[model samples]
Target chain A: MRELLERKLVFVTGKGGVGKSTIAASLALLAAQQGKRTLVGEIDAKGNLADFFETGPTAFKERELAPNLWGMSMDTEESLKEYLSLQLKIPLLAKVGVLARTFDFVANAAPGVKEILTVGKFLWEVREGHYDLVVVDAVASGHITGQLAAPQAIQELVQVGMVRDQTDWMIEILGDHDQTGAVIVAAPEEMPVNETLELAARLREETVVELAAVVANRVLPELFGRGEEEVFEALAADDRTPSPADLLGAAVGGPVRPILDGAQLAVTLRRTRGVHLARLRDELPTGTPLLYVPYLFQRSHGARATRQVAEHLAEELGY
Target chain B: MAARQRTASAGSVEQLLAAKEIVIHCGSGGVGKTTTAAAVAAMAAVHLGGKVLVLTVDPAKRLANALGLEAFGNVETQVPRQAFLDAGAEPRGELWAAMLDTKESWDDLVRRHAPDAGTRDAILANPLYKNITGRFVQSHDYIAMERLYEIHASGRFDLIVVDTPPTRNAIDFLEAPERMADFFSSRLLRWLTVPARSRVLSMASKPFYSVADRILGSKFLEDIAEFFLLFQTMYKGFVIRAEAVARTLADHRTTFVVVSTLESAPVREAEFFIDALDDRGLHLGAVVLNKVLPPWFLDEGTTATAKAMVADAVSLAKVLPEELGSPDQVGRVLREVGESFLNFQVVANREAEMRAELSAAPEVVASVPYFDHDITDLAGLLQLGEQIWR
Candidate 1:
């Protein structure tokens, strides 16, 4: 747990719909439970994170969802205004009225402004030291590279100024491997895994951030061994024979053939579960610590589910 | 034997190029839009003897890798000069490629086209303008339009092939330049500039002035004033340029090549994009259905058991129309899978259907079968070109 606290930022990213936000929220919860002031930020325009906290969309302005844990969905416009004021030292009063309105229009009109503002906001929060840990549920894979490079892009575009100064600070924070780590979350499918690997390669090529670990979510648990095969064979044999009325009580026989039919079904289910689990283990990155979250029967939304996930992560993170 | 089905007439890549000033290739993600765009440009250059430029907005950098170029930047790099020259014809025709750097290009546009230095400085200095234009604006679309304008203005390339982002993003990118230009030119923005303009005329008491001064701190207020003034001057030029590109896009030579896969979603997205093109009055060159699965699965005897199983399943359900049966069910599934391969002939034979409905538009020019291996290099583009032009 102390080793986990060594890093200031944890970026949980993966293919779209691969439970990234859930993992990010869980990590933040885990950190906060350890008494670290943690903040989880979501850059998705859909604002799905609010649902994770059992809150409404309007409840987005970094309210504490749990003890020592605050959450925010990146509000591009508001964050842009704050960034402008703080970095440029623009007086707060002067930032409003006509000037602010014009700024809003211009910001909305600018290319990559939404992405830059979103990333810039995240970078700002990271540099501000307002929290011991900040977890960003960044935009999906399609735009993540661009999102990650927003600060650098802004730095180059603005070139020598307060904007550049902020950019410099962000680069330093991100480049520090001990302070920043990225977790690539993926499912046990071909397309998402391929995309995740590609993303991992790209992140390695582009950023100095280290790959912490890969979280393979909703993995099926291994439930059977080779010993279950005999049960299936006995079930097959029972299907060929007529049901004996006294066979149910004669389970102590030498053959040990069960008169009950559901035993084979149980064995089959166990075997199928084992095969899927084995395949998942085989496909996952070897030697890299893999955290397998069991498939939830209920939708894993809201605080309760998030807490359950956090518990799983706590065990995986060796807490 | 099955009726000898004709392969859809793939309109010569050259013919399409000859016709459009701006040819936009659009499709769903992972359906080979980038490679197809490259092939079209390559074909237009090598076979047609015309200069061609292919612009890609895919952040994956696959386009650059496809052309064997080191990297895709805002500037156009000659394709033949890159490592993938073997893919082109001997005495290769001129092919240019550029990658869109949305933010930088937007800044460059602001600096280059702003009405005056004061206005430029003010707009650049204003944090709002800086953030909006730099980050929020759909840089890809603007840069694509800007790149087109630059290339079109340069008269260096006879045809420009633009590979739009995957279907959803492609539509957004195409609509972005106009949307962004309109946002900057809106009445709301004009009204927002009033305070900065009236600053000199207002002369109340010291406290009142101080309050107003605090509200519109002279520096920030002046920067906003400068942004509007400069924006006004640049707006007209930007609008005209966008319109010119739009007009070029609308021109007969500017063909909208809607690419798609055999998959239902990609096909559906392609259909939607075609509708969008029609809505914009953009010329539909042809639909190039890529990665189409072949229909031989039904004709083969080895798959007979599976076909029979499907038929039995269909018959037992009794949900299918009476005209559909065991062999027919197999054929229908095969047809659905291989629909892209047959789409061109189907569409051509039913021209009246296209005319009857607005959505039923565009002629199918070619159908390229799905490749066995992933298209990660120039060789893949060549293979795609062979299939497209065959």
Candidate 2:
């Protein structure tokens, strides 16, 4: 039941700046570490998946970022080109080349075309059995619903033709809850949590994909247990004889008040975040898994940060 | 304490807001851009006298409540004067807010530019119009700019602070007006509708349509062609308005205020956006760095104290009065306190590095300290306003 990676296709999405790419990269890395042949693709052209992997830039052509883990950035034009060549079976590359030039011109004029091409490529990979798992670092939540609903939208829009014919199979794959799922990355903030809950409901009302899990990123660790907080508060209280700030300053041979203040800030941060996290848990459908990844106080995004996130994800999933 | 390298920066943000008619807040999403825009606008209404309007996009629900909006939509609503007084502000100007309703705005555009009422109804009834515009990533960007133009032309507010939609690209909205113009005049639209208008399939477009019709089907071709043909009727009107919108954005009176946190990714994006504004001759007003940590976290002497507290936790705990707690528990708290400071130090260092690496030369850079709680009301907003007022 907790096997999000077991799905042939997983879409990772969230509000922007919620570390959607980071979670997607880590999920793929974890799958690969467990010896699954994983292909992680980013839907946005200017994705930072490469930065997370600490690898060279990715393109339409897949590059192996690690053993058993491959990375690629989705380009709808390239996708349209590949899709056309496959559908057209035009051996003379020049004919298909002319059509590719008109791709953007036509795609922009027609609505659902670019979205279908992007969704179609991922479904194509899953259908072709190119990898054991396909993790897509999908667009932010504001846009993910459109991508998820594209096949159905296309089917309803385009009544006939090859595109219409392709829609049936994509819908079949997407509608199967066991095979296709969306992992929403949330950061337990007011806006992000509200957006996550809205997206969860929208996913059910709008798309065929299942809500696999909600990965809460940058979850602040609770600094004090039950009685410890009160004691810490009393120690910092001003009226006490030889105030704790003074006592600690003399004992440590310098000011330790800032350190104490830092702890207070940490506790308050966690307390405020807890309210939102609780709301998320209560509002979500019963039994929807919520994974926690602690705040990584690292220098920057890189392979190490990605690995640390992966390890925490594995622990949350009871690996 | 503020790593404000540019000694002259803070004054410029205040001055820029005071002078500019339109201050567009642009940045990557979730960097608190909406909040910053509201605070800046609030500050303007209080300190700098004018009829100020904040054109926000997708603000948090609490924010709407804070602004005293019951059910916010495309309609511009004035912030209650009572709200100003309650915030302890003796405002010399009025503050207004309007949330961008994409669907409503698109409908408004159709009504405004449709050559005839029949054409307006037909375009409104077009299914493609409803789904496609809602799905189009750039449509939101385009509508926002277009609406800004619409409001500015009406001369309603002396200052309009726009919180730009979260765009996939840096200058998406900046180029949206031209794109709308280009889209209406595009050869693709002409080609598709030319065949429909005269029912003449030319030799050149025959093969292309066959391929397109095969994938899209003949019926869809009709729907898309019909949709564009209806839109084409408004071409002259739309093109002129779009040009005017473009002019409004490019005018020196309209400035760009880039907002971001000091996280590595956001700072990088902010710098990139700043450079984009610079290259295009759009006035780069200020870069607002939000949720910045206090400098005390990075103090060298404080780090030494934290280290000492962690190293001699038991002794430090014993030295404290018994009113605090048991020696063992107090020691645990002491150790935890030291460890937490060290933990925050890592992030503080990261933020400092990110700030140091920020390469864009924005006229002003206002740093806002991280507030421990969410700002939910007008008073709360103006409180936030104080931090960036400098």
Candidate 3:
């Protein structure tokens, strides 16, 4: 199987609030850190992606995010404009500008035009070799299949047109597993993990893209190893004389019960998600690479979290 | 774990559930929105005497099984009395559950609103109708609200709690009814459906079609126009229904509850939703904060103690009796425990900041602490509900 970064174009999607954009930014950061020239694009302009890079807002035009990484936000209108001008070779800028704007309006109402335009821009970057990797922070999990299949849907809906001609190549790029793959970012919870597994099957069955890998994000670290939990229990026991809690309380000169209770909460939280992790692993396709990103207890999701997640991804990939 | 029975008093979620005829829960996905909605409905059924219905969208099958039902669909299924009894609750009112089937609901709307059977069947059979109804972003929002309106008018349930689908924009669900009305009555629809020859002959629309025709294909354009022309027969019915749904949303008897975790994204969305509700004069009943870390994690003394334990782990380990483990192993355990607390404290502090920054909260702001386990049964939901009840 090809490595995730080796794929020319990767679309990352997950259920909302599952840290989909963070994983996309981190994966792109990791790719750039590994010396690949990468383009990271966000499909929505909610502007959170800029927060991930801790940079000023990214516009429709590409801007340098790091030495090897560039970023942009997808504007379907702008994408349509570019596609029209480039495809038609129309010299009249003002006229074609109005024409494209009107067409963009129709695209909004048309079944698949807007979706195709969004996906087409990223594929264009790959086909033109503008970057070694194009990372798309695509729409959330439930909407990705519609986005991925937009090109073919447009092709079928429009029998003869310039749009029809353009879709033929887009479909080829998307169909080639070596050139394009999708990564699912999921947390170890019932809904996200289930969505990831379902998306994996749907990607193969409903869309042209292949599942590159499954990223298990925000996985809790195990707090105890082997018999250490027994020691923790013994220390926390209320009946014991001069219990570890008491000694620790005396030593620290404050109550230790809450600290111990916090640890217990951590243990239980990890244990609960552990069931979900096991289910996710067992149910995923056998050869699919499952990567885990440790949950970061950070102040905010900005540049720092992005870098930290990149480091974890690097280590998980056997860097 | 025993759930504490907090005061279910005047300003609690309990009061809102009892008073309001309709409560709609909205939030970003994966923030326990469905669970929060179900839990509150369970409490309403248990504490307040009336028929209560929870209309959920795309619930996990385990949730149905937890309610002691195999599954349910567009039709409301009454949760068995035995299920509540097993959950240790002698319910005062009947509890019912239903999942939204968007396609079925849309078909029903057509059947009800269409002028006659011929027009209804023609509209339903249109290929573009199927495509638009299924793939249109606004259709789900419209259908969900439409179904709610239908059920609310039926007066079968004393209280109805709805879990809205996750919409990318903050106000899309709220604006859905008006948008649907505007769409059917818009100039775009009229222009698109203009007779094909007249469309070409009109000097104003010639450029539009010449451009649209090449890109979309003449056949596809004709199909869309034909479909819209068929739909135009029921425009009055749709417009009237949309107005009724919008009125229901803004009615004093209806209220909106925004559920979110203290995570930044959901909080941002929650605030947006709250503001939108306030702007529209819709009652913002309560804000339910789910999966909040316990306040003990923020105790000043606990922070200092966790730090001291991590910094002086070697000495702290030696103070313990030796039967548990070797001193080195004890030290390792001590360090891990201390570090884990410190790690969680970072998140806990952030949560505190998010909670603090949450301004303009209504009179009833409730917080549910993080549960280590998923709420799978009615008892578990009731347990969760009690935490936020007051």
**TM-score per candidate, chains pooled:** 0.55, 0.97, 0.96
Please write out the lDDT profile of model 3 over residues A273-294, one tens digit for every residue: 9999999999998988999999
Can you write out model 1's per-residue Cα lDDT over B2-33, one digit (the tens) per residue?
A: 22223365345555566667778876665667
**Deviation in Å, model 3, residue B278 alpha carbon:** 2.2
DockQ, all models: 0.06, 0.77, 0.69
What is the DockQ score, from 0 to 1, of model 3?
0.69
Per-residue lDDT of model 1, residues A195-234, tens digit only: 7777777787766666666777755333223343332233
Q: Runs in model 2 with CA error above 4 Å? A: B1-4, B9-12
- CA lDDT scores, all candidates in order: 0.61, 0.87, 0.87
How much does candidate 2 score in TM-score? 0.97
Report the number of the highest-TM-score candidate.
2
Give stretches of model 1 more than 4 Å off.
Answer: A1-142, A145-319, B1-15, B28-30, B58-73, B81-92, B101-112, B116-133, B165-168, B194-232, B261-271, B290-294, B297-302, B306-361, B374-379
How would you encode candidate 2's per-residue C-alpha lDDT over A1-319 as one tens digit per residue?
5379888999999998888989999999999998999999999766678998888899998999999999999998889889988898868778777787776667766778889899899999999999999999999999899889888988888899888999999999998988899999999799999999999999999999899999999999988877999988887677866788898898788887788888888888898999999999899888899999999877778999999999999999888
**Candidate 2 overall lDDT versus native:** 0.87
